[model samples]
Target: MQPSDSQLTGVPQTVIIDPNTGLPQNVVIIQQPSSGPKIIGILIIIFGAITVLSEVISLGNTISFGGLFLVLSAVNVIVGVGYIAGGYMIQA
Candidate 1:
C-alpha cells in the first residue's frame, strides 16, 4: 500500500523527537537573500549615465555629436536600471 500525494503535502508524518519532552525537531536549514549585486549594478549604471550626459553638455555647440551622446546616455540609464531590477527578482 502506498500513501497518496495529498497525504505527503501537509505536515511530516515522521519527526525526530527530543528524548526528554518528546518534541518534534526541525531538520532543514533556512536561507536569507542578499542585495549587494543589485546595489552595485544600479550604481554603475548611474555613473555611466552621468558620464555620458556630462560629456554631451560640456561639448556644447562646439560639436555636432551631443545628440548622439544623449541618445547613448539614455540607453545606458535604461540598461542599468533593468539590471538592478532583475537582480532583485533574482533574490526573490
Candidate 2:
C-alpha cells in the first residue's frame, strides 16, 4: 500500500495531531484586525463633546434673553455625558 501524493505536500491539515495524546484534534484558530469599532467610539465621543458645548452656548443665550429653560440645558448636558461614557465603554 502507498499513501496518496496529497499526503506528502506538508500542508497544514484540518485534523492536527495532539502532541500529548497522539490523536487527531480538530481545532482551528484565526486572527483578524479591525478598526471600525475604534473609529465609531472616537466619533461618538467627539460628537458628544460638540453637543455639550453647543448646548452650553444655547443655555447662555437663553439666560441672557430672560427665557426660562434651565431644565432643557441640564438634560442636554446629561445626554452629552452619557454619550461620552458610552463611547469610552465601547473603546474599552
Candidate 3:
C-alpha cells in the first residue's frame, strides 16, 4: 500500500487571544506524524519477509518441477532484498 499525498494533520492546540488585540497567542504547531514512518517501515519489512519466504519455498520446486520458477525465484529474491533494504532506510 502507498501513503497518500495529503496535508499533515496535527493535534489541535488551544490558543489564547487578548481582548485588546485580536491575534493568535502562543500557538505552537507540532509537525510530523511521529508514528507514520515506523508503521510504514514495519509493514514494508513484513511484506519483504513474506516475499522472500515464498520465493525460497519455490526454490525447492525447481529440482522436481524445474524451468520458469527458477528464474522467477531469482528475480523475486532480489526484489525482496531491495524491499527489505528500502524499509530499513525509511525506518532510519
| Reference-based TM-score of each model | 0.36, 0.64, 0.60
lDDT of each: 0.61, 0.80, 0.82
**lDDT-best of 1 and 2:** 2
lDDT of 1 by residue, 1-92 (tens): 87887675556577679886666874565778567766766665566556556655665553456667767666665665665565556444
Report the lDDT tens digits of candidate 3 across residue range 1-92: 55567855568988878665676665466997788898899889989999999887766676577687677778889999999999988887
lDDT for 62 (candidate 1): 32
Ranking by TM-score: 2, 3, 1
Q: Of the pair 2 and 3, which is ahead by TM-score?
A: 2
Candidate 2 C-alpha error for residue 46, in Å? 0.7
Name every residue pair that clashes in candidate 2: none
lDDT digits (tens) for residues 1-92 of candidate 2: 67887676557758768986777875565868577788888989998999899987787676766644676777888999999988888776
lDDT of 3: 0.82
How much does each candidate deviate from the true structure in C-alpha RMSD?
A: 9.8, 10.9, 18.2
